[model samples]
Target: MHPAHPLLAVTHPDPYPYYAALAREQPLYWDKTLGLWVASHPTAISAVMRHPAARVRPLTEPVPRGLCPGPAGELFSRFVRMNDSRLHTRIKTLLMAYLQAQSQQACTPQWPAITLLSAVQADRFLYAAPVHAQAAFLGLPDQLHADCAVQIQAYLTALPANANADLIAAGHTAALTLQDRLESHLLAAEASPALRQLRDDGARDGIPAALLAANLAGLLFQSCEAGAGLLGNALILAGRRSLDASTTPAAARTVIDHVVRHDPPLHNTRRFMGNAIEIQGQRIEAGQTVLLVLAAAAMIEPDNAWTFGAHGHACPGQTLARSHAADALLHLLHAGTDAHALASHFRYRPLLNARVPQFDFSKDHQP
Candidate 1:
């Protein structure tokens, strides 16, 4: 029951029990070994997320030589977890055009095909579907979908501790491959009239091209893994509840939200304390790392109803992600197909930062 045992809870598959204990016993307890405080209460969690002193940092700062390795190391170091606010803002702005384009394209005539492909492929076709969807929105060649799928799988399958060196090397190569494609697309977009128009007028202003590209690729990586896991989790939960196809869609959305609350893709976001702060009466030193457990807070907070900002630092993407999930579920439920067929294919792995599930669609679907 020591506060220093934070990793104990993290390593456990279902950390809710541990989180509940921490919430009751040590709402703002600091772990000396981990050099971070666990804020388990809703108020504490919100405070940490919105606090001006809270700043994102690398999971392991000053990344060791030969640790991440090669292209993967370079990309991770350059783009993510560097704690540069100016760069982050720039990237966020630049990607707005692509995000908007994605939104617009989803409503077009091509949507039915894309939706059908997503439904039929489910988890198995994560690479092709998401890439194709992205390509459609970005106006890239659809032929790259297969290559993107292979690269993504390699990246996801890499182990954390005691990982195979060869696998890591493959991951680096995959990242480079995707990076090249993304760069090419960016260059082409700069020259095209339609893409140029969007880039000039629609894209968020003041974003650097490099940062924009990095964030776009990062988004793809995040969404591909999370989206697949969510689809699988939703289907399984719906079937276990014995919900009918008509009701399954709505139930799926509820279950997905619950999953995000109970077992989110990301367990924590690392933030470095910029100034001395007190939480629940304990003073924390500056430069300390604060692990904000969004998933744990979401579960512990009252779920009386769905509302934006229900708890502080509530996801801005909550509405959009939920809407997408709801729509996907509804489409699946009304497909005149057995819902259970898709539910049984989920298999999960222990992800360090997020909960990821492996999906197999070749089980029993008659196509």
Candidate 2:
């Protein structure tokens, strides 16, 4: 069955055909059902994103209201992806240079271990593997990689408005711990040349170390769920092709790369208008939002990398994220995981945009 709407399509069993049609025939339209505009074609999506007044976060409520008055909110606000503050350009440039330089060093992620290759274990591994790899990429201690995943999960659980008091409190505590740890690492004498350079540049530019630390932690947050989706989808593609532990590392990476083009982790992203704008002959008022169907646009131009986004808001960690997912996949295969068996029995997690899969599940609930 077709999904009821674009947001619903993220979890739909087969959404590509619908997405293709969306990009072809209905490039941009008002989804009254969703109370916003939808941009499916590459042209329309680009138009909305390139507009200056279309900010990442809403103008009125910059940080999520639920997270306000809490450490979690502060950490969230400091992330480079969350705002277009004065320091944004400088911070992003610094991080980009740091990541590009760090990529040259040989670093292998310590893939999380599993006692069994059961469906439940795969579920846990999917989310943890990426965070573990990203933490290692940041030159964090091997012993702390697992803790990074746990803390990030707890922190994420507390972001939504309906979170319970206990979860929210736990999230605040987790945020503080992460901030302190990353800040210490960023300032430690033993830091790598690349990291040290980033620190010196941030200081020279008057960028706050606290903000730099939160963004360093933000790298983990960025990689977790989306990385799971990319890895999970790649596994499904591998299953269809009968890929196994015997597959060469090069072969595994090839499959992962294909997954990025055809079945990406993120399906759509949004742009909130700070001022009224006309796009594709449609007038969208201020405060309105345009849901950019990245997956849909990919159908039009596979190499465009609409999944990582485009323009100033494009994700700087694209290269790192892909390599991390590829390595994680190879690690899972070498661990004797039955990709075909696991892939045959799973459902997509109920996320607004990401398409992560859960191997262990009851038929009762999504995600």
Candidate 3:
């Protein structure tokens, strides 16, 4: 254990403060216990994330065999989690096509409806509205949305420390169940125009039904987790500013983008070193893992935070994600919510990876 490593603790909410110190003192700091190098500086992080020698592979080797056992193990083994370079690029290309299609059709149409629903259900159900809307966009039935949310939450709950063995088992079980449900839906959607077009366009395409299903479930799970965080953060910032109800959609987008840069959906992304390489005057051996703390890097040089990467790895979906958030905020502003009240309800998720808040609509809103 690196005595200075903040991640050693089970409940470290934000790792930025520690990361900043690391970047200043030990930009190439390595933790033996974790068997990974943590980079905090913008240049260092960007170099590591885009480094040619840095292989994007799963943590399959030296695996915590006990952590994920049985079916969860098998699922992880079979999924795209372990892919890299050629395979990763190929899969990502296919997935992008699918995502692009969905974004243009389903996502665009559903945003307004989702915003309306979120506002209507604000006082009564708060968080459930967006989760349900996510499920709806994925073509899931209304009844299954709550079940899906429960399953996702169960899985997340089992991830933190102090999680029980039984809880882990239950989370794995729910995940598998959700996977099965998603598979059935994907098969049904195969005949749909959008998906059919995707199927027809790609030749070497064999997007396993299981993969599509898992991806959909993963997207929703991620969206709810991260979207909620971003929304919460934005509300808090907007409230602090006492932003006018007449705030333009474009300005709201600027606020959301700033929030994402300051506190991204994921705190860091892990990559394995494929070969010996020198980064910031330190040589990292092959098979060594490197963790790029994006959230920390975002704050290092706030002015240049928007660039995802000098290389193409910058988030391709940034534009879309920004648009979606902007639209949602515009909807809230247009609905006549008071800026200060909206901000007051902002409370972020106490997770390390993402800095998202939980908005208490019931407490913040007025009739």
Q: Using TM-score, give the best candidate's number.
A: 2
Rate residue 48 of model 1 by lDDT.
73
List model 1 lDDT by residue over 1-367, tens digit each.
4323544454454667776667667667777776677776667766776776776653345343443657765555545434445555444444554465556544311122334424345555433334434444455555665566567666555524465888788878877876777667666734444345435642456444554555445554554555544544555566666655577555667877875555555555556777888766777778787766645565566462112333322333344455555555555556543456555555454454445444443454311
Is candidate 2 or 3 superior in TM-score? 2
The estimated TM-scores of all candidates read 0.70, 0.97, 0.72
Write the number of the candidate with greater TM-score, choosing between 1 and 2. Answer: 2
Which lDDT value does model 1 have at 204?
54
What's the number of clashes in each of the models?
Answer: 1, 0, 5
Off by over 4 Å in 1: 1-21, 32-36, 51-53, 59-69, 78-82, 107-139, 157-161, 189-198, 201-208, 243-264, 273-280, 285-288, 300-320, 323-348, 357-367
Q: Which ranges in model 3 have alpha carbons more than 4 Å from their true place? A: 1-26, 31-36, 51-67, 70-86, 106-133, 141-143, 189-191, 199-204, 244-248, 263-265, 274-276, 285-288, 299-316, 330-348, 358-367
* Residue pairs that clash (backbone atoms under 3 angstroms), model 1: 265-354
lDDT by candidate, in order shown:
0.54, 0.88, 0.59
Tens-digit per-residue lDDT, 312-352, candidate 2: 87998888888888888888787778889987998888789
Global lDDT of model 2 = 0.88
RMSD of each: 6.1, 1.5, 5.9
Clashing pairs in 3: 229-356, 347-357, 347-358, 348-357, 349-356
